[model samples]
Target chain A: MNIERYDRQTILKEFGMEAQLKLQAAKVLVVGAGGLGVPVLTYLNAMGVGTLGIVDNDMVSLSNLHRQVLYSETDVNKSKVVTAAQKLKEQNSETDIISLETYLTPENALRIIADYDMVIDASDNFPTRYLVNDACVILNKPFVYGALHSFEGQVSVFNFEGGPTYRCLFPEMPKADEVPNCNENGVLGIVPGIIGNFQALEAVKMITGIGEVLNGKLLLFDGLFNSFQKIRFSLNPENSKIKALQDSYDFNCEVSVNSITSDDFLQLLAENEIQLIDVRTPKEFEKNSMSFAKNIPLSQLEERQDEIIFEVPVYLVCQSGVRSKKAVNKLKEARANAELINVDGGMNEILKHAIKY
Target chain B: MEILLFGIAKDIVGRSSFRFEEGDEVPKSVLELKQKLNNSFPDFGKLSSLAIAVNSEYAQDGKSLQRGDEIAVIPPVSGG
Candidate 1:
């Protein structure tokens, strides 16, 4: 170990050489390599965490550059885990950075998480959040949790020293369309940085026993108002009694919508005169869109239902595939017989093929 | 009673905070508060995993509310 590299932190009265050694011996796993994961991994590695693991199957896209500052413009379209691991290793050579280019699914979550001393739930979806909570509970591992929505962000430490778990606060996962994610609802670029830094601080505290960990407390930050609030919660004994993982954490089970890949949609467009609706905002539509696609943003779909032809198969698309699925659900409520097919991967995937508008 | 809204609740109500004035029919419990919000904004009922905090402490559905209590409605946010 390079003893002089960490002189500043170890020199502190509260955090002595003992704490530095603890950080060096810890093995932390960060679940996402996006906005929140960047700060958590960066700070933890810079602080000399001995072993770090990154899990993410997503590739860096142009949209992610706003908040996921770790990746550069040149790094776009590259694997996030691979890119992050390479940069993190450059920041600190002594730290062992393990990159797993895969999404956290029910089949592999337990196996991947069992090897780490603690986990950082930096994933960007509800299914992965619940899966991390259940897997940590089942394996008796502690994890630091962080999430964001628009201008507000949340941070908490779950399953740490008998503290409250994420399930103890929000017992059930929200339905697929109940709440909008960062992809649908915009988030300030700095919000994730602030929330992720909080997560890293809590993780350092938990590992080094330097200060009071955010055990059983959820910290909410509203950047619009520049205010912070902490909600104290207690553990539900039943939550810790989770003996096994659920068969599936997917909340989209209720509504079944047919989906076609972007490539297949392109093929169909060439062969037939198909009806396609771009469900993104007007600004997004103006930026780039298929010439055949009609603009009917998801927010205004209700009032513009008459503009769509229900007799034919109507395809829905957005920046990503999420909002299009929501549009399908909304359209189904109004016209149950309408055949709505969501374009999987949306424009992001279509752009990959370099097809002309 | 003053109610604070976070995440989707804030968007549903179209504001950060609101007050249930003395002359209004205020909710007496967490469950009633949620019902009141759901009655006003139907979207509130769609969120299956909403949490309520009273005076910075997590409250159960049956927990009684007082006129001066500070209540916050927090919905799950799935962004990183």
Candidate 2:
């Protein structure tokens, strides 16, 4: 270890050489390289954490450059894990950075997490959050949890020394479309930086025995108000009794909506006049939409059910396939027997093929 | 009683915090508070998971409330 590199943090009387040594010996895994994972990995590596692992299957898009400061304009369209690992290595070569270019699924979560001492739930989706919680609980490992919603952010330490788990705070994963993600809702670039730093601080505290960790207490920060609130919670014994992973962590598992590929939908469109509903906002629909599709924003789906023909299969399309699936689910509730099919990949996929607007 | 909203709950309510004044028929329990919010804003009912905190501590549905108690409605956030 380079003793001079960590002299500043080690010089503190409370966090002396012992704490530095603990941070050097700790092995932590961060499960996303987008917003929260960037700061967590950056700080942990710069502070001389021994081993760090990054898991993500997403590519650095133009939109990610705001909060994901690790990636630049040149890094767009590149794999997030690979780019993050390379950048982190340049920041601190002494820290062993392991890059796992895959999403944490039920099958691979346990095996991947078992190699690390601690996990950080920095993912941007509820499925991965719940998967991380369950996997950490089953493996008897502690995880630093951080999530964001627009200007608000949440940070918590779960399964730390028998403390409360994420399930204890919010029992079930919120259904798809219940809460919009950053991609859908939007987040201030600085919000995740603030929250991720808190997560890194908690991880260091837990590893080095510094200040009190946030176990059983959820720290909520509202940037708009410039306020912080800590909600105290207790562990539900039932949450810790998980012997195995659930069969599926997919958010859309609850609603079994049939789907068709954009290519197949186009082929069907040529053969027959299909009833397609574009569920994107008016602005999005006006920007680009198929001539045959009807514009019905998801926000107004409930009131405009009469416009959609329930006699034949209704095809739903959005910017991405997410909102289309949500539309299918919503329509299913109103007309249970209605045949609804979500256009997979939505307009993004359809645009790849030759088609007339 | 003052109710604070976080995450999607804040968006659904359109304000960070609100109050039920002295003579108002405030919710007596966490469950009633949720029901009231759901009744006013149907979006609250759509959220599959929500956490209520009384005096900055997690409160179950049956947890009783008082006039001066501070309540927070927190829904799960799925952003990084």
Candidate 3:
């Protein structure tokens, strides 16, 4: 092993040569190679975590450059795990890096996660997050959880040291569509960096047994206000009682990925059978909206929901796709018992297709 | 009272902090505070749960809010 490469951390009394060896023997899997995965890979590789597996199906895109720091302009259009693996291998010759250039599906999650001692959940989507959590629970491996939205980031460790699992903290999944993701709400670039650092620290602490790991607790960081709060939680026990892994459900249908193109949306409108629910604010609907659409702003949706006529399927539209997604989730939560799909691009799609302002 | 919003709560309210004037609706209990937030931003109800913290400690629904307590709304985050 290259002792000089890890001289800084090994010199500490808690993390001497013995701890270095422990890191050398550890294997960790990091899901998603986007904003959070960048920092996680950098730290674990630099710290000489023995065998690291990187799994990501996404390719480097121009939009990812802001937060996914590991990739450069030249690396765009290439496989993320491949590019990340090459860079990580160069950073530390003593550490072994494996690149799994595929998405973590239920078919592959168990097989891939079974080989690692610990898993770092850097996934940006809900379905994958739940999948990782459930898989970790069944496998009996502790996983570090990190999530960032807007200016806030949350960090926690699930199924570690007989502590609470993710399900214990979050029992039911949020109606897939209502959850506002960074793609639409927008994010401050540094937020994920801060949260990802916390995730990496948790992993190092867990492996070295040096400091307190977030067990049955969550650390919330708000970059805008510059405050940190730790929230404690008790295990639900029922959430942790997963006897077996279930079938993998597709995120698009189960969650909020149901999007119909402007042309198709207009075609459906012409049929006049389906109900059109405008989820935008009253001002937005007044400014521009379909002629047959009912203007039920998202904020006032529940109070005015009787207009929905639950027996029929509903199509939702907003300024952008985000609000419409939220409207679908709201309807689902109310158990309206009807199919709700968002207009693919919302008003943006209509404007693009020139279907009418 | 100023409620510090984090995660998706900020997105729903479109701000980092929400201030309540003396005359403005001052919710005495955590549940009332949440109901007030929901009245303002109906999307708040969409989240599975919003953990509240007062003076850096987790506050229960029945916990009373003081005049100048540090309150934070921790909404669930899924972004990486």
Candidate 4:
């Protein structure tokens, strides 16, 4: 590697040659090649962070071009990790870039994150964020957290050597619907640039051991006001609740139909006159049925248009809420006039309530 | 009490503002203060995940509150 390429960063007294070499030997994994990941990757790569791993399952959309600088208009439909790896390589061949062309799930997250010295949570969703935080906590790795919405951004270093985990600061995840995403609420392109760069700085600081690490503190940035605030955090012993999150997290976060009781269902049924549309298999429907309900097995619902006349509100019921939600979504796509609701408890909940066939 | 809004809350709520009220008693928990705000401005109930702070401190969900303290409601942020 040519030393002149990083003369600017090397000149800093704190980040001298020794620190640069540490950065060169560092293996960092950046999850998500979207808005925040773009700047974080670019800065780290430019500063000669040796081995970089980029993971993302999404391709470039037209809307993403405004903030995702690694991609161009021509790379619109290309995989983000692939395109980003290629561009980063072209800019600085000194850095070895690896691209994982798949989504990070609980099953594979531990292995993938375990290989890296540091992890950056640049993904957009809460489940993935929590997964990254938990995996890092379990493995005892340092993970940098950065998040941006509209003109504001938050950066924190969590799950590092007894430092605060995301769970310590926020023990519970929020309902998915409470927050509007970039698709619904537009973000200023520069907002991510500002945040991602700060994340990159944190990554470098963590690697080189220079400057005050965010550790248990959360840093807030406002692009609209050009202001920054740092809020301190402490490790909550109850955050140990995250220890059980290792393997069986699936059951821990699984959506059960049991969340809503039979009484709640009855109230909704009476108040909204909600009609149950069982989308279970015909054999399953024959085994049990709800009174005042229509049987439209999921397999035949698409072909049997006359079976469902969507004049009234429909509550979809299946073995679990998963298939019913899909059926409801399909019904909505079919331009049905009914408002869709998923009886989360499905047949199990119905059976528990002793609903007659 | 005064509250600060950051990230998603700052964006959606437009800007952090203040309200004038008088009370002798301090609240038992941050959730109670949150309820008071939600009742005062019903529109904010939609932002249930928004985290709150007391006097520039990261406020816990069920922690006690005091009078004349500064408070801020920050939503679950999604940036990086």
Q: So what's the TM-score on candidate 2?
A: 0.88
What lDDT tens digits, residue by residue, belong to model 1 across residues A1-357?
A: 999999999999999899999999999999999999999999999999999999998888778899998999999878899999999989999999999988898999999999999999999999999999999999999999999999999999999989889999999888767888887788899999999999999989989998898899999999999999999999999999999998887666567778999888888887899999999888778877989889998889999999999999999999768789889989989998888899987887787665345
Q: Model 2: per-residue lDDT, tens digit, A1-357? A: 989988998899999999999998999999999899999999999998999999997777677889999999998767889999999999999998999999899999999999999999999988899999999999999999999999999999999999999999989888777888887688999999999999999999999988899999999999998999999999999999999999889768767779999889888888898899999888678867999889999989999999999998899999768889989988998899999999987886686553344
- State the lDDT of candidate 1 residue by residue for B1-80, as single tens digits: 99999999999999999999989888999999989999999999898889999999999999999999999899999998
Better of 1 and 3 by lDDT: 1
All candidates' chain B TM-scores are 0.97, 0.97, 0.91, 0.64
> What TM value does the first chain of each candidate achieve?
0.91, 0.86, 0.74, 0.73
lDDT of 2 by residue, B1-80 (tens): 99998998888888899999979999989999989998999988888889999999999999999999999888999899
| All candidates in order of TM-score, best leading | 1, 2, 4, 3
- Candidate of highest TM-score: 1
| Candidate 4 residue lDDT tens string, A21-68 | 999999999999999999999999998999999988777766688998
Q: Could you tell me how far off, in angstroms, the CA of residue B55 lies in candidate 1 after the best superposition? A: 1.2
Model 3: per-residue Cα lDDT over B1-80, one tens digit each = 88888777777888788788778768898999999988988988877757787776666689998778778887667787
- Computed on C-alphas against the true complex, the DockQ of each candidate is 0.91, 0.90, 0.46, 0.52
- Listed in order, each prediction's TM-score against the native is 0.92, 0.88, 0.75, 0.75
Tens digit of lDDT per residue, candidate 3, span A175-254? 55566667645678878888888998999989988889998888888786788778787676787778676675343455
- Give the clashing pairs for model 1: none
**What C-alpha RMSD separates each model from the true structure?**
2.5, 3.5, 7.4, 11.5
Provide the global lDDT of candidate 4 against the true structure: 0.76
- How close to the true structure is residue A110 of candidate 1, measured as C-alpha lDDT? 97
Model 4 TM-score, all chains together? 0.75
